[model samples]
Target: MVKKYTVAIVASAMLLLTGCSQKSDVDASAQKGAESADSKLNQLGAGDGMMKLSDEEMKAQLIKDLEGKVESVYFAFDKYNITDESNSKISANSKLLGEGKAGELKIRIEGNCDEWGTDEYNYALGLKRAKASQDAMIASGTSADRISIVSYGESNPVCTEHNKECWAKNRRADFKLLP
Candidate 1:
């Protein structure tokens, strides 16, 4: 009975000692960090930090800054190779991308095709065309990381008329800018 009583007393004393211990520095620092983060979030919500633009505003700004500055690279029918004529266009685009706001923006190369081949074939061809343009841009000093490729195939045709001129217009790679 005495041993049991001593053990209970010792356990109670240990509990009391632990309960009375001071908070650790880690706990205090964590609390301080949480408060600092909350304050920063509040400041950001109140627009005290850098200005943020709305999606529409950003799109308009991008259009204003880069509309028609980058030209579409046209490819020959049933071909994905960058021709001699397209080199001039690629060089001009690289120059534009190297300077001003265009340099900082990410580029999307959209590959388009005429309604001549099967959907699968057109998609593949379009992808190849986009890849070719991407390679050309990289060769002309544009960072490959900044450029992305997408193939719209025949779904996004610039001209819908079933004619040579219209099909020629549709076979192209167009550049888009992203924030």
Candidate 2:
């Protein structure tokens, strides 16, 4: 009876201690979980720290980024063929896109015409100019998803003067990157 009593007393004490320790441990674990949730909430992107990108800023940066990275593509007086220099620029853009320099890139092709051709004809030519660049990009390996085409068709002029220098600037394709 003495031995049985001792064993029962020891077991009862151990059980009591275990139950007490478990409660404290559970409380500590709950505190840790709360801290972790707060940290996560403070994180940016996944939390209130997320930033909103302005469209104007995005457009300006993309245009500037593309400045020398892709050379200006020139169109003929009335024809649209992959000009040697323009083709080279398109090839570079395609290579960059293929190599992952760009992610989900969106390019806008803006075409313009000189004052010579009729608005209707020049508009078609301007579209052809944009399409020419599009073809080059596609051929070089840029997915259509990364590109868009628009034709300003003499409506939007880089230079207002009526001269070859101004005409050259006006008769061109402009590439703008969209976010």
Candidate 3:
């Protein structure tokens, strides 16, 4: 009976001590959390300390960085072959792609056409133009896997005016960076 009484008292005392320690631990954790939150608030109030960039700011920075870097290669009427001038432009872009300075971004080749043919025909022509550019880029040492081609035929014309100049402008392959 004495042994049983002693064991019960000891268990009670241990539980009591454990309860007190757990409460203090919780209090300490709460205090630390408050301190950390206050520090973050202070940083935000000071207009500094690693704040997230606004969307506009991020967009502006991206545009500024990529400005004039992307090159467009134009195609002749009903032609899928890359012209000499377009090949030169592709060479320049290939160097940029090979250098790895643009990070792990995928390059999108957008193929477009003049509004003279049926939608199906134009789409095929656009794909051909894009493939020509892709082939040239790959030949110039760009990784084939890093490029993707999309054809937007007879649609999304850069110049809405129905003229030769506008048509010429529309028959082009454009390069875009994708994250």
Candidate 4:
């Protein structure tokens, strides 16, 4: 009777310990996934010595980074005033461009428009958008010589869903740096 009782107690303890270990392992995995998600939303996922990307690497990464960093202020049919919301995004990109104490890079601002406007009008509007971006870059300490502007009008759109919503997306500027 004593031996049987002892054996039963030992088995229950082992089972409990195993279950607790599995629970802790699951908790650790959940924590890791949450950290990954936070990195994605806030900034580029980087770690250790690899976090500091080189100037060449930075230049290569600018186009994609700027796409997410820069916000386009929508105009009412035909206008060029920076909105309050857009100002914030511009400010962030400005800091990123100005603060990096590294090699100077060349950037091209490509302006675009939706298909609703006339080709010529859209070309000019696109130019206005490019000019706006170029001016902002200059204000951010990027040299004028390093920045150039081009207008794509309605010819090239990052999105082509072909509606008011899709057209709005095309009516913006793209910032690309030479890598």
Candidate 5:
């Protein structure tokens, strides 16, 4: 009887130990998963851990924000000079560039002209308009080295109607962020 009782007690102890070991293994697995989640959250700029976004999601958000900061300044008919309103807008762009909000991105100033002039003349006028905007940005604080100029001439019209208002809209300088 003593031998049987000792055997029974040993079996029970072995079973109990096996169960505890399995539980410990499960706890360790859970801890590893939690750590992985925390690491992903941190990479996405989520310190508070309320929500987590993937790397691609974070990148898209950043790109959208940067695009919204881009500004376009318009020009008067037969003129490449910057108006007061356009100057203020260019100043804002300069501030953004100087503050590093736009990162190390280069800018393209696209000059466009109304359809009233000959192709060659319109092209020159468009280039002048682009240069005017570029100069204003530089004067307001943007680095001249990071800017480029292009003239689309009267090729790309924002409004197709043959009207004064449409022509005014067409004679404009567009800003583009280059890679």
Candidate 6:
């Protein structure tokens, strides 16, 4: 009986040690996995060497990197059709917005007009212009769900001077990025 009791105690201790060692092994593997993920994020520009950014932070960084890179699609004074020159701009913008970090963002297409017509007429024209640009972007492979249109009419002109150049600048569709 005494021998049996001693053997039982020894077996219990061995089982306990085995369980503890398995737990430690699991912990080690989990740590390794976390480190691997962090390294991958760093490689993708989503993290510093030591830490990962939150989703909002990464989006803000992407927006900052992409600012001013997208060119506006300019329009003729009374037309909403996409011109050849405007088509090139739209193609470039679409390519830029369809790849890498920019692909994950939403695009806001702001349509503007010069001070040449009534407020209602300008607003309608601006909306039509915005729709034309949006269609162009979609045709160039950007997702329709990711693009939104807004008409600013004559209220958001980049240049307010009374010249043809200034008016031309105002008659454009601007691109804005959102998280």
Best by TM-score: 6
- Model 4 scores a TM of 0.57
Residue pairs whose backbone atoms clash in candidate 3: none
Which stretches of model 4 miss by more than 4 angstroms? 1-74, 101-103
lDDT of 3 by residue, 44-155 (tens): 5555636778766665566446636868988889998998999999999888755644535678899999989966989999999999999999999888898999999978
Best by lDDT: 6
| lDDT for each candidate structure | 0.86, 0.78, 0.84, 0.71, 0.84, 0.90
Model 2: lDDT to the true structure: 0.78
Q: Which ranges in model 6 have alpha carbons more than 4 Å from their true place?
A: 1-53
User: Which has the better lDDT: candidate 2, or candidate 4?
Assistant: 2
Q: What's the candidate order when arranged by decreasing lDDT?
A: 6, 1, 5, 3, 2, 4
Model 2 residue 155 CA deviation (Å) reads: 1.1
Clashing pairs in 4: none
State model 5's lDDT.
Answer: 0.84
TM-score of 3: 0.67
lDDT of 6: 0.90
Q: What does candidate 4's lDDT look like per residue over 128-175, in tens digits?
A: 988887786676566788778898888987788977788777777776
lDDT of 5 by residue, 1-179 (tens): 99999999999999999999999999998887563546665667536565677766665665466668867788888999999999999988778756543656677889999889866989999999999999999898788998999999999898999999999999999887765
> Which scores better on TM-score, 3 or 5?
3
What TM-scores do the predictions have? 0.66, 0.61, 0.67, 0.57, 0.64, 0.69
Local accuracy of candidate 6 as per-residue lDDT tens digits, 57-90:
9899888777679988888988899998898999
Rank the models by TM-score, top first.
Answer: 6, 3, 1, 5, 2, 4
| True-structure Cα RMSD, model 2 | 11.1
- Flag the better candidate by lDDT, 5 or 6: 6
lDDT of 5 at 118: 65
